[model samples]
Target: MARFYCDACKEEFEHSSPSKKEYTDSFFGCCWQYVAPCPQCGKECTEKKEPQKKKRTSSSGGGCSSGCCGSCSCCG
Candidate 1:
C-alpha cells in the first residue's frame, strides 16, 4: 500500500501500488487503469498504464476478496 498526493485536487490518498502482473496487464490492455480515491478531491481517478485487456474481470475487475475459490483453486 502506498500514498500519493494529487496536485490537481490537492488531496492525499492511500493507494495500493499495482502489482507487476497488474501493471503488465493494464499496460497491455487498451487502457491500463488503476483506481484510487483522491483524498482532497474526493474523486476516483483511473491511473492509466500501457493499456492491455482489463485484468480481473471475473468479479468486476477485482480479485477474490471474499475468500471464495475459483476453478484454479483445487480446494474449491
Candidate 2:
C-alpha cells in the first residue's frame, strides 16, 4: 500500500494503482486510475497514474507488469 496525502481532504491513506488493461473504452484509453477514500474526510477520490511498462525475462515463462502486484509500500 502506498500512502497519499490529499490536500483537499487533508488526510493520508493507502493507494493502489489501477489496471488500465482491464478497462476498455474511448475515454479511459491507456491511463490508469487509483481509487481510495480519504481517512479524515471520508471522501472518495480518484487519482490517475500512468501505466509503466517494464521488460523482464523470467525463467518461469511468465511476464510481470510494472510495480509490485499493482500495490505499493506504505511509507508512513
Candidate 3:
C-alpha cells in the first residue's frame, strides 16, 4: 500500500494496490501515468511530503480601494 496526500481535501489516503502496474492494469489500462484520486474529494492525490509554512504579507496602500474592480494599476 502507498500513502498519498490530497491537497484539495487536505487529507491523507492509501491505495490497496502497491505496484503501479497492477493498479493501472486493473483500473486504467495502457496508461503508464498513474495518479490516485482522493476518496473524500475525488481529486488527484500526490505523494505525501513535509508541510511547508506559508509566508504572510500585509496589504499596502498601493492596492485597490473599496468598490474598485481591480482592473487598474492600483490593484497591482
User: Best-fitting candidate, measured by TM-score?
Assistant: 3
The TM-score between candidate 2 and the true structure equals 0.33
Instruction: State the lDDT of candidate 2 residue by residue for 1-76, as single tens digits.
Output: 6555566866666766532233456986655445566767766565534479989643342224333343334311
**Which stretches of model 2 miss by more than 4 angstroms?**
15-30, 46-76
Hey, what RMSD does candidate 1 come out at? 14.3
Better model by TM-score: candidate 1 vs candidate 2: 2
Model 3: weakest 10-residue lDDT segment is 17-26
Candidate 3's residue-wise lDDT over 34-63, tens digit each?
Answer: 368788888876666567999965444435
Higher-ranked by lDDT: 2 or 3: 3
Q: Which candidate number has the best lDDT?
A: 3
Model 1: which residue pairs collide?
27-50, 27-51, 28-51, 28-52, 29-51, 29-52, 29-53, 32-49
Model 2's number of clashes is: 0
Q: What would you estimate as the lDDT of candidate 1?
A: 0.53
Q: In angstroms, how far off is 31's CA in candidate 1?
A: 2.2
TM-score of each: 0.30, 0.33, 0.40
